[model samples]
Target: MGAATAATYFRILTEGPHVHRNLSTPQLVEAALARGEASLAANGALVAYTGSRTGRSPRDKFIVEDEETRTRVDWGKVNQPFPPEKFEALLERVVRHMAERDLYVMDLFAGADPTYRLPVTLVAEYAWHALFVKQLFIRPEMSELASHAAEFTIIAAPEFEAVPERDGTLSSTFILSDFTRKIILIGGTKYAGEMKKSIFGVMNYLLPERDVFPMHCSANIGPEGDTALFFGLSGTGKTTLSADPLRMLIGDDEHGWGPKGVFNFEGGCYAKCVDLSEEKEPQIFHAIRFGSVLENVVINARTGEPDYSDIRHTENTRAAYPIEFIENAVIPGIGGHPKNVLFLAADAFGVLPPIARLTPEQAMYHFLSGYTAKLAGTEAGLGSEPVPEFSTCFASPFLPLAPRVYAEMLGERLRQHGADCWLVNTGWTGGAFGAGRRMSLKHTRAMVHAAIDGRLAQAEFVTEPAFGLSIPTSCPDVPAELLNPRNAWPDKHAYDAQARLLAKKFEANFAKFDALESIRAAGPRVSR
Candidate 1:
């Protein structure tokens, strides 16, 4: 069984009496309510719960090691190899399970740009999952839907649990992708993010072959037509910072850098809702309305309002809404080549500069290192404290190919386009997580605006010895002492010790990457 067999199964399922194809938002929401899958919030947003699993199960994800991907895919812990035979069997089981239930199907586009957009078909077992993807992915016009044909299909049966012994899965939940068959199979977990990110993984593998650099970053454009990208992992402020009221947001996450320019890989945003407030993030707060889907957010039973502070379910609560819900979002989500690129790091160790300008080599080094403290609740097994780790290109989980593929592509694009690069630590400051406070959002925003608007370029710079990053002497609307991390720390010796430890971590991580001498030399100056 292969692509042809998979296609035949999908056609049978779609044409079956239990199938509901292309249901509108209202109809899907109604269906979800009737099925008791979700409830309506006071603000009219649909609130759903992902029982047991609140975040992605990376260990459970597998990519088929068929003849097509045998040499192309990077076979390791991240891209775990699943036997082609096992995948076909698992897919058959999932399809059979879905065929017995009321299936909801949605056809959507992944990329905003027509030239590179991927036509996707999602076969879901729940109506809310259909609503979730409908809002998260680009919706086509009525006329376009008439001729729509999916290049890839995702068969998701959340209620259908896999038999680990027979399916070769670590747990009951499984996310299996077969590039040769052009199909993704998901089961056991109801977390809708698996569906969204599976497509992202596909794009990450497909686009680079087409000379397009697929990025896991947020993008926005200024009034002067200058576009900027914010690269970071979840809970790193990529979505919060890019939703600038003054600029038009291209997308919150997932984009492609092609010959035309930067284009959004999604039609909407999936923003973290932990401690979310209108006063802090007005755009995201307001964007949650009638058509949006809120996952695991605690709604007050008495008032029906959402309590963003509640973490009983999980700290990784989320809100998904169309980009148009944001008043300043750019329709079609296309922009000119970025004038600036910022690498965001949540340094829980509190040693990195508040903001620093990166030379091309330094940019490449950090891009490969992609160091950031893994915040709690962002993933399933993470502890409460922020753990320091390097997620290559800030997107190791989604990349099916090797890290070098993305890094080389980024280096080429930055050189050809001459985009300015900066490193901003949106993490802790002064001491560490428990000892020091998180960086001020206002101050971070001021520094970001200064860097992108060309104000910080004229400021004097001092080289930090630990990471060899150029720290600006001053930034408008930011305190002078706060620009340097050592100045804010009460115990300078303690700060130095932490810096040395982090520098060693960087050195150890970079040792594995086979990069140019200059790129390797750009890493931290670890003093033994």
Candidate 2:
């Protein structure tokens, strides 16, 4: 859509002459607060609440089942099929509802690499939502905006609710994407994640055809120009680990690895803010200042201070800020081919070692498996107690293609780049959640630093019996006792039983993949 055409589309719905276009941060913050959509916190951050729905509703997300996406997309539980007529009807309702209302529109790009970047047009009902995409997406310079054109457009009207029977929707909350029209529709939910993730899903669909691997991971580069990638599901420390002080952060979440190199898919970082502290995470701590957006975070009304520890709203509390907010962030957020790739899993079972090396075949196997502990409050249905589940590619919900498509891309990238891969468990140890404790951040950081610095390569390694992974006996500044999962446990028998049980789970999950025998053999060996 061209700029003039986009303005005309908004004009059809807008009753007044009030259409805000690419407002500055200060202007957006002031407009949000003045309109009673947001409040200023003690730290000078804008705190906005996404009522009822604090996380992305994957169940409510659907892709229009048309000739364009019917056969191309992996249709299943995550990528639910929506009738073409249903989407068209919903779009009409949304348009009528939004009509006669002042709208906030922001035109931006999704990728940092200009070669592969996507020009996006975001039309939102709320000022905070406008400010959100403004922070999350790459802002175009005045010169760039003059000749700007949008490849995809997103229209978010959270106030409008759908009737399932009348609208042919599952619920009042609906997020539908019609790629053929290059448009996305979201309604009945104020959660801004839906807006951001919908574009990510689009990239996941379109980029693969261009031989670009869109990853749900974080990337960073060292002072020596060594780049590393961390792949994991939410609450698995992909953001925390990637925001290293010594290394320049490329991005906290979502990236694309292609023939050129690795480039961040986002211009902002959406970090989990529950229990956030300045002492522990100073980088993220400092990032939350003027113009940053805090979602579902409880704030002290009197003092205007944010209670990061409060879960009254939801444990999925988050802080969204521009990439430049991080003091050590790399500008243009691009990095060379990664020298190391770390697959992070929060192992609630406490069976997997804190760190283990992966062979090339094993890397592909685990990449497809995408094992991780489902943390509480990370999703709509999950409980406090961690549940072990396999999320294919660490992002099954967002992926539009088959799992094998991404697995093959990852395998090819690793081999072509000669990157070393490792599985790092950032969850419990000694026993399951109740019996064991979460891995210390300091210790995990130490081990990660060692791995990135090539110090772990010189350390003595022992083969772990349960999964057949090589674990280092010693890591600088980390306790030797914590290196082995068996040694950390007081009861060796309990550890062995738990390890074998986890191995069985891995085997069962891997069986579903129609891969070569060698790739399957790379999986865990569980003795019956």
Top candidate by lDDT:
1
lDDT of 1 at 229: 99
- The worst-scoring run of ten residues by lDDT in candidate 2 lies at 6-15
Report the number of the highest-TM-score candidate.
Answer: 1
Error of 1 at 398 (Å): 0.7
lDDT of 2 by residue, 472-512 (tens): 99999999999999889999998888888888888888787
Clashes of 2: 1
User: Which tens-of-lDDT digit does each residue in 45-98 have in candidate 1?
Assistant: 999999999999999999999889999998898999999889888888887887
Cα TM-score per model: 0.98, 0.96
lDDT of 2 at 4: 69
lDDT of each: 0.93, 0.89
lDDT value, residue 311 of candidate 2: 88
Which residue pairs of candidate 1 clash?
none
Model 1 whole-model lDDT (C-alpha atoms)? 0.93
